[model samples]
Target chain A: MKLKEIAHSRTGDKGNISNISLIVYDQKNYDLILEKVTPERVKAWFSESVFGEVIRYELPNLGALNFVMYDALSGGVTRSLSVDKHGKSFSSALLEMEI
Target chain B: MKKIRIGAGAGYGGDRIEPAIELMEKGDLNYIIFECLAERTIAIAQEEKLKDPTKGYNGLLEYRMRKVLPLCKEKGIKVVTNMGAANPESAVRVILNLAEELNIKGLKVAAVLGDDISQSIENYMHLEVLELKNPLESIREKIVSANVYLGIEGIVEALENGADIVVTGRCADPALVLAPLVHEFGWSESQLDLRGCGILAGHLLECAGQITGGYFADPGYKEVPDLWKLGFPIAEVSETGDILIEKVDGSGGLITTATCTEQLLYEIHDPSTYITPDGIADYTAITMEQVAKDKVCIKGGKGRVRPETLKVSIGYKDSFIGEGEMSYGGSNALAKAQLAAEIIRNRLPIIGCEVDELRIEYVGFNSLYGTKIGEVLNREHTLGEVRLRVSGRTKTRAMAQMIANEVEALYTNGPSGGGGAMQSVKEVVAIGSIFIPRSDIHVNITYKEV
Candidate 1:
């Protein structure tokens, strides 16, 4: 099953950085989930041209996944308030990843 | 000159409205601030959004907003809040609908966006700025959400743009009120002393009614009175950063030095290292006085330099978990449950599955209070229950299924087994933090005329 098809996810704002959590439907597919889902894969899925860092968290009890992407906010954190940077919100196509 | 009295509410999660409104009604307050996010609350918010996208914003409880917004609009008080969890624009849409329903005019609602980072996590990890003790490991696949608790500068920009009701995503709670105070007082961002003062003021009043009497009630705790109508806290911050922690007159609870000290000590590990997105506040220099029945005047808080690294919260995919429970009768019930958990642990691996954390709790035998009691006769052993819990990072639904299946097998193969068997196990996910350098992290504030 696709990641988006099976997991429940949500995103938050902090300039270019965003947090995403996903819950798998079946426990048996966890290893398959991890094997297919990697930081490099996620980075490629989300950004057209990679810039900054991606951090992840593993919560066993909640059956969920969390990701922190930094410098995604254009101009990095310092220019988070400038108007030119606000237009760079995360693309919805990247949000439709299947892993 | 008229005093621009701004009021900010405090509390963990979404419990800041009633008291904020009460203070607005009685104290002639000009601005109201509400703090409603924490670590656990964020988890809960994510869970709610999973059920329904619109339900994610926990602070938009109508009961809380209904009591306060109308009055603030009538009194010409501008309201600002970070109650906008996953969806600030949707929250703003709701507030504007409320304004229309109330027949209130010229209520401009603006949503401060661009903080959603769920899509760009991978790119962030590659920057080499995030310092993690462990290299991106197995958990990197489990990340569900990431949001940096932002500073108050964004709120200042929104206010400058003439937005009366400024709604934001995840701003540092204390900055909600401090931003307005900084703007109204014309305090410069470079004034470390003034900024530190604002941080101190925000800290004191952040946990609405907490400094007064929400969590730590004195010896007369029972007589605190009308807790249902407990007022949220309001910070009367000055240009110098001194704040008066008070509530609406005749509101429930008392504000005293003892209460203020108790609140200050809440969740505080080190008094000298109270940090916020705005700056680091020094609680060591704080002094509190019971200025009135419901007023505690706080002053003399100093500050130091902020850290060059920004704290980052990251999560990744782990394992799945499933749990169940069973009850037993008779005196030897407690011992049987203990043996059962051990048997399952030893037996599960044999069947090709590994368990990470396995625990069996004796519900009726002092499990919660941290007291241990031995299995004995003669003493009345009221109904007892055992909760078998297990966790693993492996892909083993059968492990959980087998544990449950074996629990039923204990009815015949195990000793003194009379009760029914239940199965419970959960998947494991890892959560850790990485620090991003100041030079690597970027933030910008701009103005958009409405």
Candidate 2:
């Protein structure tokens, strides 16, 4: 199953760092997410797009995981030549991650 | 417990004024705040201010004031905003003039200044906080504007002095909401938890309708009603720092646990330490309860001491961006768009244009998803119509313009049935951050009455 099936995500960018929150639709899926959605797995999933390290911060109470991707955006919006300047659609890309 | 109701009127500059007008008329708000400045926008506003001293505030400042100030004055709802982007003085003056034009009496406005550090940025030793890894001194020649992120103290001071409206330049976004809580409740710096609650409330409402389902609507699953009529958020903050987030009756949008959760984590890197100029708020244990439809109760915000250094947004001229797009339809549209992209990529270097970076995308198929999903999707599906988009960055506008010109030439030179051609060349004002000792920036507030 794809992560999007059980989760909804949103992406926010500050400077070159891209933070994507993978929030579960149901709290019951939290354990599943914890086991499969490791930072190493996410880093590997986005290896082609993200150049830097990936750090995941957990919020079990909220049933969410925040993935802060360093150097993910070609550059920050102001300097990047990419069309999706703010990386608004990056969350959709993260949701493509299969579990 | 004594409570104050504050409404987030505008999220960003150029945000719709109708929702704000709706808030002032019906929200029963004691204060309405407009977080109009973004990180890099003030730098661009500074450019305008330098050209004409009286013209640096948000472009729609007067229009917004004209529409809402009359109702706000009648309702006794105080207004607070960072619409004073580069020139608080000028923005304050504009409001005063508008009040007079509307025949509103005793309209008091406070302008908070001293955030602009362009004059003294060169004096400090600072490293670039974002991209373009260079010392502040090295980028001195290209620096356009530098402003520090001030806190709630100045806003508190203005309210203490009986300001009807407070205008600021680059104060932290949350400060716009937190200041009122501090002023109304008399919360001290030692009351970290109370302040943190207020900060969290401000963050939730700072983006106006964001927490109220504007950004949460997903057609079938997370359905939000009457989204076009979506109401901006209002926070009822109790003295103890508890808040009930809601929207006015008849206003569109839903306030739910899911919407609040999405916004709570929006742009936040760490839940435990969400830093603001006021204090470091810990949102890790925060809880949300759906009190009713379109209403949510928020609590559990803890705070720590403020950062010793202040973050400064520095803007400098980076490069010019040239973009061009042409749409294609009929048989093999996607294939035609791909060819058009290749033509622009190959043509740029041939014309002696030294592009620092370049991107060619087929918009209909995979402009946003990149190669990961795009490659797999392209193999299975075919696009009926596609737009070829070519964007590049270069030092000179002339060179950047060449990239767009080459794309437009493809319409007449090759790719059959190309239509809706568009091209643009824009100068990029790149923004980076640097931290300066808090003592280095001095904040002051002055009042003007009409």
Candidate 3:
């Protein structure tokens, strides 16, 4: 199943950085997601868009994980020529990740 | 102390006003806060301020204030907002006159000033930019506005002085909601733990309808009921920082644990060290439970002392962005779009129009993710229509307009069945973050009564 089936996400941006918070619907899937969804995996998943390092923060208490990507947003909102400058749709794109 | 009901009037500058009206009328709220400034909006507002000294606040300030002031007067609810954008004093004057026009008596409005550091930005030029790690002098000439992200000090002072409405330029978005909590509950500046919870409530409620399921509906998967009539959120916060998140009864959307969890992480970077003027809030320290229908209880968030330096957003003229789009439908739509993109790519340099950065993609196919990622995701489906989008950033507005003109020319010059051509040129107001000593920023509250 895709990550969207078991989990959901929200994308937030600041400067050239973008952060996505991935929350699982069930706590039972937390361990699996935590093990599979690494910083490296997420950075690679957003291959063309994310050029910077990806950092992950764990929130097992709430059955969620946060992935922060530096040098994202192409050149941040004002500078990025992207149609989705803030990378708001990056949340839905991350949901395409297979689990 | 009694539990205070605070409702988020708006999330951003151009958000829906009807929901805010509903929140004010239906929700028995003590306070309604409208957080209007975004990262780049203050700079845009600054640009307007340069033209007209009396302007530069939120464009919808008059409309929003006119609609809500009557309700606030009727219900005896106080108002707080950052709608003052680049000029809060002028905004306060506007509000004061508005109150007089509406015949609302004895309305005390306060303007919280001192965030605009553009005049004295040179004094801090020796400081290094936080994100770029470069000296502040790097882009010194391009600096248009520099406003610090203030905390609750100004608003607290305004409330303490019995101001019914508090207007500010740029403070932390959460401060609009947090200041009232502090003033009503009498949380001292030293109470980091209690203030942390208050800030937490501010964070959750800052985005208005978002917590009440504005952005969480996925349909057939994560469904939100009556999303079109989505109700704004109301935070019932106790003195100890215990919060019950709910909406007015019969309002649309919901407040489940799922919705709350999503908002908890929205726009947040480090869950453990989310910085604010008050303290470093540990967002992960809290747990959310669905205590009732359309209600969630948030408890237990920890915090440490705030950083001595405050965060300042420096807005500068970045560049001009030009985007042009043309849709191709009927047979061979994808092929025609590909051809159109190729022609524009080959035609640009030949036309002697250069840009700093360029991206040409097929909408409905690969505009979001690149062609490679789109292929991996949408390989099974054959596209019936493709919208060719050509976007570029350039130093000059004319060059940006030419970039858009090139796409519009494709109607007769390149591909057939090209329709609905849209072109837009935008002057980018880029923002950068820097820090200044808390002492350097002197927040003041100026009051005006009607």
What do the candidate models score in CA lDDT, each in turn?
0.58, 0.87, 0.90
Clashing pairs in 2: none
Return the lDDT, model 2, position B121: 76
The TM-score obtained for chain B by all candidates, in the order given, is 0.78, 0.98, 0.98
lDDT per residue as tens, model 2, B29-100: 999999999878998999998899888899999999999889878999999999999999999999988888
Candidate 1 chain B: worst 10 consecutive residues by lDDT? B369-378
Please provide, for model 1 over B358-394, each residue's C-alpha lDDT reduced to its tens digit, 9 standing for 90 to 100: 4444555433211212132114555455433322323
Ranking of models by TM-score = 3, 2, 1
List where candidate 3 sits over 4 angstroms from the true fold: none
- By TM-score, the best candidate is 3
Question: Highest lDDT: which candidate?
Answer: 3
Candidate scoring better on TM-score of 1 and 3? 3
Model 3, span B1-450: residue lDDT tens: 589999999998999998889989989999999999989999999999999999999999999999999998899899999999999999998888888999998789999999998889989888888766888999899999999999999999999999999999999988888899999989887888888898899999988888998888898788888988889999999988889999999989999988888888888888988899878888877988899999999999777898899999999888888889999987599999999999988988998888899998888888887776788777888788899999998999998999899999998998888999999998988888898999998888888988
Q: Candidate 1 has what TM-score?
A: 0.67
- Could you give the CAPRI-style class of model 1? incorrect
Residue-by-residue lDDT tens digits, candidate 1, A1-99:
345455434433343455444445455655665667676776755553236677665544334445556655433222222222222223222234555
lDDT of 1: 0.58
